[model samples]
Target: MIRHLVLFKLNEGVERDDPQVVAGAEAFRALGDRIPELRFWECAWNISDRPIAYDFAINSAVEDTAALQRYLEHPAHQAGVALWREFATWVMADYEF
Candidate 1:
């Protein structure tokens, strides 16, 4: 399986605990149920970076890189990109074992 991980930093005016952040977290957590190619999805918030925890994160498990690519191009995900424009920086990494 391929593990697709992502993290985000919100725009300057956005609060870490804002409703948009909360909603995005929930939406990501629900992707597994909405997308057939998604084997698993996890969403997280309020991780303490000072204590070694990272920013908001998503860990998606897919059957292969092709499946992950499909997920990346999905319309639903595109919609999310629009809604999440307030995010400042987004980073992603993939690993397979």
Candidate 2:
């Protein structure tokens, strides 16, 4: 399986309650049900107060590289990414397990 992880930090001055941030978060949350390639999915806001913690996270898995590719290319995923691009910076990693 391929595990895909992403961590997002909201842009400076952007609050969690901001409409764009909320919409961007909801967009990612909905991907679990919208994408067929996902074998597992978990996404949520960070509960930590630590300075190093990211504001949001996404932990998901797929069957293989091809499945992972499909997830990344999926229209729903693309839309979510587009929304996030406006208010956040993120990092991602994918590895086979």
Candidate 3:
């Protein structure tokens, strides 16, 4: 299996309640139902108050590298990414388990 993790930091001055952020987060929250390659999916806002904490996170898994690739290329995923690009920047890590 492969674990695909992502951490997102909202752009300076962007708030969680902004319409674009709300829709982008909703789009990701729905990906488990929309994508067939996902073996696991969880995403949410960060609860931490630490200065270094990211604003949001995605914890997901797939069968392997190929499955991960499909998830990345999926149209729904691409759409969500496009929306987020306007309001946030993120970092990611992927590894086998």
lDDT of 2 by residue, 39-88 (tens): 99999999999999999999999999999989999999999999999999
Model 2 per-residue lDDT at 75: 99
Question: Which regions of candidate 2 fall more than 4 Å away from where they truly are?
Answer: none
Order of all candidates by lDDT, from best down to worst? 3, 2, 1
**What are the lDDT scores of the predictions, listed in order?**
0.75, 0.96, 0.98
Give candidate 3's whole-model lDDT: 0.98
Candidate with better lDDT, 2 vs 3: 3
What tens-digit string does per-residue lDDT give for candidate 1 at 1-97? 9998887777667876688766666666667687788888877774575754456777888999899889988877766666666654678899995
Q: Which stretch of 10 consecutive residues in model 1 shows the poorest summed lDDT?
A: 46-55
TM-score of each: 0.80, 0.98, 0.99
Q: Rank the candidates by TM-score, best first.
A: 3, 2, 1
> Could you give the C-alpha RMSD of every candidate to the true structure, in order shown?
2.2, 0.5, 0.4
